[model samples]
Target: MADIKLSGIRKSYGSSEVLHGIDIDVKDGEFVVFVGPSGCGKSTLLRLIAGLETISDGELQIAGQKVNDLTPSQRKIAMVFQSYALYPHMTVYQNMAFGLTLGKKGPLGGLLGGGENKKMIEEKVHKAAASLKLEPLLKRYPRELSGGQRQRVAIGRAIVRDPNVFLFDEPLSNLDAALRVNTRLEIARLHQELEATIIYVTHDQVEAMTLADKIVVLNDGYVAQCGTPLELYHQPANKFVAGFIGSPSMNFLEATVTDIGPEDIEVVLSSGKVKVRLPVLPGDLALDARVSIGIRPEHLQEGSGEVFRMSSRVKVVEQLGEASYLYLENGEDDPFCNEPFCVKTNGHSSIRTGDSVDICAALSAVHVFNASGIALTRTTTDSRYIAPRRA
Candidate 1:
């Protein structure tokens, strides 16, 4: 187990910079995940850590040693790429032994042409194969193995090296849905057994949420937020973090401060005649401020069973067996665009589309943000907002 640190790391191509001073720390044996949309520099950061890309500036330390000048092969790091780059013509055994065979000091040094060297290489291969449950298919070619088998072989190849850090670059992207789940479980087991620091990169939120001890959410080459999956899910740092971390995503509604007093602010939405109360101290709040109110669909309840209620016209309804989302024709400014406020109703819900209904929301479940789309520190309602924003 080793700790990896990046301080003020930056990357650039010509005059256009891709990464802008990213600083992250991975504790010994911690499984960290980098998640973001495509072209968000998640892969670039991984490459930089693997020494595959040059750091434009800043320091990279592994196990308290500066390794910026070290090459990929010398970094004591192993990377499993998305493609599973295996030798098509070679058997699994030969492929796994290739790196060790090229060495002049390892147990497999110059072994392909001799007896003892060959035996050592074969033994190591068998051991790795056994670990990955690939011993039965050692002689099989890459093409002969199924997708999952091939992926295991790729991981086996890395496991044999016994490197300090294992970097996975979207390793499960190529597998089928079911196979991906199976492989994901396998990775979790492998980490428990090896207890090595593993940095995984993937755009799939599910993967990041499920596998990481901490998730680093990146956006436009910057760290948007870093925390446990539930932290990012429950307490997002900003609007972007809130919107990006969830599955159905939080619903945002345009609103104005109707009354701002000492602790709570009153807000009114265009979709309903009801006045919604926001629990936040008015010290930092701007009166008559243009603001946005965000709430998870799951937070909005369908009957009189909730703490607060607001009425709206249901525009569309999507049923998913376990739950349903009611898209309401409710918005002041295009908070969701007719993206409609998705309300997750109960399983086999009795609600229907176009049903004019009263939706209830727990006051504590609301997330209020300023017009700039920055999340506000919500407190219990006091009273401050007394007027709406002037046009």
Candidate 2:
């Protein structure tokens, strides 16, 4: 097992800087995932750590050794790519043995020396195949294996190298959805068995949520939020993270403050005529101060709750079979600008059409933000926004 450390690591291409100075410490035998939208420097950061891309600045250490000046081969790191990168013509055994054979040639040249060394290499190959469940097709070629099996072979090849650290760049991206789930479970099991430190990169949030022990959320070449899945969901630092991490996404509304109190603040929708009291004090906010309110779809209900309530024109209704989402449009110039605010209603609410109806939002479930979108702390009204605990 190894602990990987990156301090002030940076990379640049001419005038465009891709990775800002990033400091991350990956604990020994931990699975850390780097996740973000495409072109966000996740892959670049992986390449820099693997020595495939030279760092424009900063340091990378593997198992307490500084490897910045080392070549990819000298770094003793094994990487698995999205394409699997297997040689099509070589048999499985030959492919697995290729790297070891090449290393032997640089020194003792195993076969030219003795049969015992070759036997030792074969034993290690067999052991790795067993670990990945690839022993059945050791003699078969790459064309004989399924996408998942080919990936297993790729992982097997990495295992045979026996490096201190394992790096994966979206290794399961090529598989279909169902296969992806099965392989993910297999990988989870493999990690426990090997107890190896792994660094993985993926754009799929669900994959990051499920597989990573710790998730690093990146955006625009910088770290947005880093935490366990629940932390990012329940307590987002900014609006961008609040909107991005959830499934149906959070709801945003522009409104004018109409009432202020020591314990609660009331605001009217910027769309006009509609007002709702939220779970925050109106202190320091001007009487007519314009602030935005954020609430998750799950926090809304068609029926009344302990706190705030609203009314709007139903623009679009979607029944997800498991749950329901109703979009409401308030009176405004641009339809989307006065776009339908979303609410998570019952799977069988049975409410439909031009329903100028009232909706209730529990005071605790509401998140109040200032003009600049900074989230305020928990208030008496917000005390009710309790997260559903996982059993």
- RMSD values for the candidates in order, in angstroms, are 6.1, 3.7
What's each prediction's TM-score? 0.89, 0.85
Candidate 1 versus the native: TM-score? 0.89
Candidate topping lDDT: 1
Worst 10 residues of 1 by lDDT: 382-391
Model 1 stretches with alpha carbons more than 4 Å out: 105-120, 261-263, 270-272, 281-283, 330-338, 379-391
lDDT of 2 by residue, 251-365 (tens): 8877778888877788877656556677675547878887877888888888665457766777778999878888887555422244357888888978786776577776677
Weakest lDDT window of 10 consecutive positions for candidate 2: 381-390
lDDT tens string, model 1, 96-169? Answer: 88766654553455454433366777788889888789988988999999999989988988887778899999
All candidates' lDDT scores?
0.83, 0.80
